[model samples]
Target: MSMTSDIYKTIAKKSPESLFKDRGSKFIGQAHPVKEEAEIERILTELKNKHSKASHICYAWQLGKNYEHYRANDDGEPNNSAGLPIYGQLQSFEVTQILVTVIRYYGGTNLGVGGLIQAYKTAAQLALESANIKTKVITEALQIDFEYALLHTVMRIIKEEQISVTSQKMELSCSITLAIRKKDLNSIKKRFDAVFGLTVITENF
Candidate 1:
């Protein structure tokens, strides 16, 4: 699909980590896919707890297909030395919905501001490169309910449109949750709306 056609780039299924050392300081960087700010906080908390003795924990993250939200934190490093460089690496890779955290262990030597920037940048780059990166379609979840008689029609539209059914419940009345690519969602919704007995119960982005 074209770049503008309902698609986004994100890390594959797994997170990756890397380590870098400059002078005597050790930098450990890890990359993880975060679908929400809550996940970001949780991951950061976990990392901080895991490396509680580290000198600093710095991070950068971008969210949304359009990169609607992003932040970088130096974590006591000299100004932009730790975070901005890490964020720049993410931009270079063109990946969103990801967070990268770098933990430092002060190895009894201070790698000046420039040295810190390079070390963090290189560490984040290594983590990202070691990760499995992939592109995915931007999708929205939709919950649909319909009478049993309209099941055939609904299923046919879903098949023709290639919508992924995330969950379903079949009974006297039926319900199905679908993951529909953003570009195809409106068209598919219109199709289901035309069927009198079909009802769209909830839509989640």
Candidate 2:
């Protein structure tokens, strides 16, 4: 995705589990696509339960189309050694709306902080590399209201603009919600505003 574009890159689904070994320690990494902060804890809990014997579970996640919200957790590892390294990989891959977790199982030996960073970074990178990355357009919803008599005109404009109608209520009066690509919002809104008796309301998503 281009830096100035309304498109963003994200994982399409949960990635296959990946593993990295360093000295005697084991690091297992997995990446998941997430939309809300609430989903993060649930995923962590499931991983904890699945890896009950593991020593630590470090993770990092980026959310929003603009990558506005994010978090990193060391989960008991040395500060900056585990979570930050994992997060760096997310930045390196230029992906958002994703969570990458590295589960560690102590193998009876201590990898120094440097070693731990390398191990976690490699694990996270491996997980992301195995993921199905996809580019998605950022969109906004527009609520359009018009009279039934003008349905054909409104529908014609929608078709011409290739806009997707997400929901609609057609009666003597008509109300429809459209999902508009963020980049085309201004031009599309202008077109609808020019039509007499039509109302357009912008809804950010």
Candidate 3:
């Protein structure tokens, strides 16, 4: 699929895990759906505390439905041996808004750089394979404001456009927060703009 396409794929939820072993070394892989950058640290902290004895914790994450933001960390493993391999799986699946972490317990025998890369890649793949994935379309959050007199017209447009309203405040004035799928954003914006004396503002959630 085109990287700039309106639709994308991502894990439906967090908590999928997989395990891999090589030369007595253990690698535990986990996949999580992340909504924001700060969430990455929260997840890593929990995993590190839980696996206090692990020799290394490596991970990769892609943020944004379009897979625009990403990161990979090797956590002291040989350069490129652990993190890049894990990131390769995420890219291969063409998925985003997710994070994958692999925790390794060292075996007495050292697996050379190639071996480490393979093990990490395989572990990440297995974790992703175990996840329930879903397709998502690009969407933008919008806030609409209008006087009470225009409520009926606004509601009609909302229904016709099939916008997902997140919150609404209807006092003397009306304010609504909703999400507009990318495909419908322009058309919806035009329709709302035509409403007399109404105001529409777009923002990211």
Candidate 3 Cα errors over 4 Å, as ranges: 1-3
Residue clash pairs of candidate 2:
none
lDDT (0-100) at residue 28 of candidate 3? 92
Ranking by lDDT: 2, 3, 1
A best-first ranking of the candidates according to their TM-score comes to 2, 3, 1
lDDT of 2 at 145: 97
**Highest lDDT against the true fold, candidate:** 2
**Candidate 3 TM-score to native:** 0.85
In model 1, which runs have C-alpha deviations exceeding 4 angstroms?
A: 1-5, 12-16, 108-110
Report every candidate's CA lDDT: 0.87, 0.93, 0.90
Give the best candidate by TM-score.
2
Window of ten residues with lowest summed lDDT in model 2: 1-10
Candidate 3: worst-modelled 10 consecutive residues by lDDT: 9-18
Query: How badly does each model clash, as a count of residue pairs?
Result: 0, 0, 0
Question: What is the per-residue lDDT of model 3 for residues 84-138, given as tens digits with 9 covering 90 to 100?
Answer: 9999999898889999999999998999999999999999999999988788878
TM-scores for candidates 1 onward, in order: 0.80, 0.93, 0.85
Of the candidates numbered 1 and 3, which has the greater TM-score value? 3
lDDT tens readout by residue for model 2, 6-30: 9899987899999899878889999
